[model samples]
Target: MRKLGTVLAALLVIMTAGWAGNAEAAKGIVIDGSTTVGPIAKSFAAYFMKKYKVPVTVSESGSGNGAKSLINGSCDIADMSRSMKPQEIAAAKARRINPVANVVALDCLAMIVHPSNPVRALTEAQIGDIFSGRINNWRQVGGPNFPIVVIQRESNSGTQETFKELVMKGRAVVSGAETQASNGAVKNRVSQTRGAIGFVGLGYLDASVKKIAVNGVIPSAATVKNKTYRLSRDLYMYTNGKPAGVVGTFIDLPKTPDGRRIIQELGFVPKY
Candidate 1:
């Protein structure tokens, strides 16, 4: 009788421990990052919650802030439009976090202007000059004589970093350039202002604004996937170490058929 009682107590203890562990693992997932990657993350979150019954929250505070959130342990996934910078990796290592990137999609920074603007293409050098204030009039670029309104993303934006590296080639943006918070915001401003020019992820393109060719190459899913678009970059989701449990499933969603459809629907190119 004594032995039987001891065995049952041990089994109960094991069961209780397992339940506690499950409860901890069920605490849900948090995602933070770029407005460029926001639509994909939100759509994936919705699908995950419906299919797996796992609660997930997503926030688009820009890529720099996404790295900060992951390093600070505030988010499980960091959606970034660019690779983690060296400093961000060092910061994560300092916090005992191993940052791992999963490429989820491909995107290009599409130069956009008002639909009424007839200037349809720009060489990379010309764009650099325009944004840097060297070429500030529409007439100089084969359009009506209107003062060009140059728009840029905030300094903390990954999109801004990419634009500076890819298009600006170390040139500083004009001191008078306007700054917007997100891809959607830039698209909105460009759509409303005839003389305005801005850049946004390919996903943000719509009839509200017109996309211009960069160096004679127009941005399209095929163009981005085939590497014909020079401005193409990979979109990423960063996690601490290898993701396991629900986090693993969520991060790998891009490899699934439904995820590809969702990416296409949102105007982004699926990487897997």
Candidate 2:
């Protein structure tokens, strides 16, 4: 009886090991980077997990960090609000990671201020001056007589890079400007601070704050798609190579009807 029991115990152990190995083989994909893309990524992750029974993890550590993760092979997908720069591409090449961009949606970088602000619109030059610290007072731009508070995204943010390129026009943002890490943080700071001015993706806009038109063009889905909004940019998902398997399906989500609905529901311009 002892010999029979020992053999049965060994067989059970082998069967359990096989099950464990199968479970390990079912590991899920990981996505990280860009708080601006966090909402969309999370929504897609949730839907994919439910529909496919495949686990997916998403994180928002800003765009620069996302690129770093992809180059380092730590993430399966890197969501970026702005395109990768030349230096970034070079770095990836050195690491043997071929970063392929998958354009997912369109985003308009909306300039936001407290609701009480009366300024209707600002020219590109005026917007540039305000961020660069040249126009330090709200009264300088025909608003109330108060000092302007500039809120900017942190240095590692993709939104900050885009804002500097498009709105600053090669000018530097003021050193004294307040830097927030995420779009939600910037929106909250501007909504609560009457004299504050900040920029966020169009999807982040809400009733808590008011958006200002740039060069007479208000940021909307139509304006962004038409390229009439100066602050518009394409959102991207970067894979190490041409995406395959689960990664390919996730990146291709925006082209489907359900994915298009998800993009539009989140206030972004859907491609399909």
* Predicted candidate 2, C-alpha RMSD: 5.1
Per-residue lDDT of model 2, residues 144-237, tens digit only: 9999999999998999999998888788899989999899999999999999999999899899999999999998999999999988998999
* Cand. 2 TM to true fold: 0.90
Per-residue lDDT of candidate 1, residues 130-195 (tens digit) = 999999999998989999999999987989999999998888999999999989889989999989
Top candidate on lDDT is: 1
Question: Cα miss at 137, model 2 (Å)?
Answer: 1.0
Global fold similarity of model 1 (TM-score): 0.90
TM-scores for all candidates: the values are 0.90, 0.90
Worst 10 residues of 2 by lDDT: 21-30
Candidate 1 residue spans exceeding 4 A from truth = 1-26
Candidates' C-alpha lDDT: 0.94, 0.92
User: Clash pairs of candidate 2?
Assistant: 34-62
